[model samples]
Target: MKTNFNKEWKKDRIGSAHSGENPMVIAKMRSGFAAIGDTQFLPGYCVLLPSKAFGSLEELDFKQRSEYLLDMSLIGEAILKVCNPRRVNYSIYGNTDAYLHAHVFPRYNWEPEERIPYPVWQYSGEKWRNFEYQYSDKDHGKMKEKLSNKIYELMEKAY
Candidate 1:
């Protein structure tokens, strides 16, 4: 099975998703593509990238907006089934990426107590840079496949 896509996938995420080159992609939904995140600091972390890049959610029409939100939550549901995290947190901020995308983070009970009630960003920067948390074929392939398969199943039920 495919592991994580190459780093170059970031240069054209939406395009890569469309071309079927983004190995990180879990599934393509009505409004966008759901993909595994670069870092697996949170095992089930994923992102929803619109089929076409838009600067913000406001750029999308009402139907597109609703579809995007629905697709994002569908990804969260797949994460819930695959990773079994305590809960999932969804966030949309295009500040860094400069495009419309939603992050789906699965919050786990096993996380440090101090950070449990806080956002995932509360984790030290080291958490983001640490190699152990980085995605690798040996480390994350199985879970990614599980997530992809579950998402396909859920999407089938959803649409």
Candidate 2:
């Protein structure tokens, strides 16, 4: 499906970060923006969105592509430092959204035994759509702070 970037993301999220309207943004990286995920089913889930919208990774120049991927890793590392999940799952599929972005999902040891050994996609639709897992400033304040701090620290070390 074709996505309306202006209507879906840039209008509500992308520029919101620059204008201080979106609190989910953790840090602005070399080639993109790092932000916490809308859902917290896995707690430390996050996303890496490119600074400039692209249809896919192949659309970016080599350097920008590398930087974007590196930024994704930085986000995973920051999550590892803060949440210490069992493993981090990285995915860059644009099938639904049609934008070049990466998802960083931290898998925990405490997850259901059956789900632990498989990709997060194995989880039910209810798990993904549950309002109970929605991000809230009140509930996720500490996590947001720690993740933001760690991301900044990692970014500084890279410079």
Candidate 3:
């Protein structure tokens, strides 16, 4: 499927995923969609978007919650394999988006010594908006392909 680089998917991430309009989507997992992040400032960053929209994790029943959490971790593992960062960090904060999407960050040891200890959010706004850090198929396509394949491989092994 073609990746829609335009901002059309911003207004409706989950809906766009359902319609296959979100360019960031890497794979459709059992519980949600595994998508590359909008910014590549931290390469291999990703988000786990639920197939069905919900305000928070608690909105799901026990089994569904388990699947979602497992999917999140699996993506983290995939990131570890593909990105080869020092480690992976998983975060689910509905504060800004108010949706049940989890962030899978591949933390690297090469990051600035001062910022390495802080959360990805602690980065400057300029880093987030810098064109160099933005996600593009040209710069990130190969890695995304590897990550997508690894996610599928891990999923198969997982189940």
Candidate 4:
């Protein structure tokens, strides 16, 4: 069996430009930052992708590592200002994708699901299962058609 099964990063990409699904994305940092994942319990659970191509912070130079941490801090602050989560959690484990990224999550005071530490994915049993598989263009436009413009404005301010 092949140990180094090189996964195609492009296939599973999640950022706004890549996925073309999530509307919550406000900004994407340069390569030396983090990846794009479900920012956790918050509405804008985001991933701060590493600016460099690799995932090992230890492998990075002093400058690279410092910048990455700075970027993470900035992203976390932005998320808190935008999402207003009760608390924030940062986790960096590249076991699955082996990409350099930070999991930026906002823990709120009130969560709808049962008392557990699992993500919404584990709760829903699938990704984005609360919505339908696909929708017509009309429904797509209608999806955000009702939302106030203030949210987008806030994103601009936060990002």
- Highest lDDT: which candidate? 3
> lDDT value for candidate 4?
0.50
Q: Once superposed on the true structure, which residue ranges of model 4 sit more than 4 Å away at CA? A: 1-25, 28-41, 112-159
* Model 4 residue 2 distance off true place after TM-score fit, in angstroms: 35
TM-score for each prediction?
0.93, 0.89, 0.95, 0.57
Question: Which residue window of length 10 is worst by lDDT in model 3?
Answer: 1-10
Q: Give me the runs in candidate 2 sitting further than 4 Å from their true place.
A: 1-12
Report the number of the highest-TM-score candidate.
3
lDDT of 3 by residue, 1-159 (tens): 233456778789999998998888999998989999988888999999999889999999999999999899989999998899999988999999988999999999999999888999999999887777888888899999999999999999887
Residues 1-159 of candidate 1: C-alpha lDDT, one tens digit per residue:
224344676689999899987877878899989998878889989999998999999999999999899899989998999999999999999888899999999999889899999989779988887777877768888898998898888888888
lDDT of 3: 0.90
Instruction: Give me candidate 3's TM-score against the actual structure.
Output: 0.95
> What are the RMSD figures for all models against the true structure?
2.1, 4.7, 2.1, 8.3
Off by over 4 Å in 3: 1-6
What local lDDT score does residue 36 receive in model 1, on the 0 to 100 scale? Answer: 88
Model 2: how far residue 56 lies from native, Å: 0.4
In model 4, the worst 10-residue window by lDDT is 141-150
Write one digit per residue (lDDT tens) for candidate 4, span 1-159: 211113343434444334543333334443332333332224545566654447577877887777667667666665566567776677777887787667776667787647346654454534343233222233332222222233334335544
Where does model 1 exceed 4 Å of error? 1-6
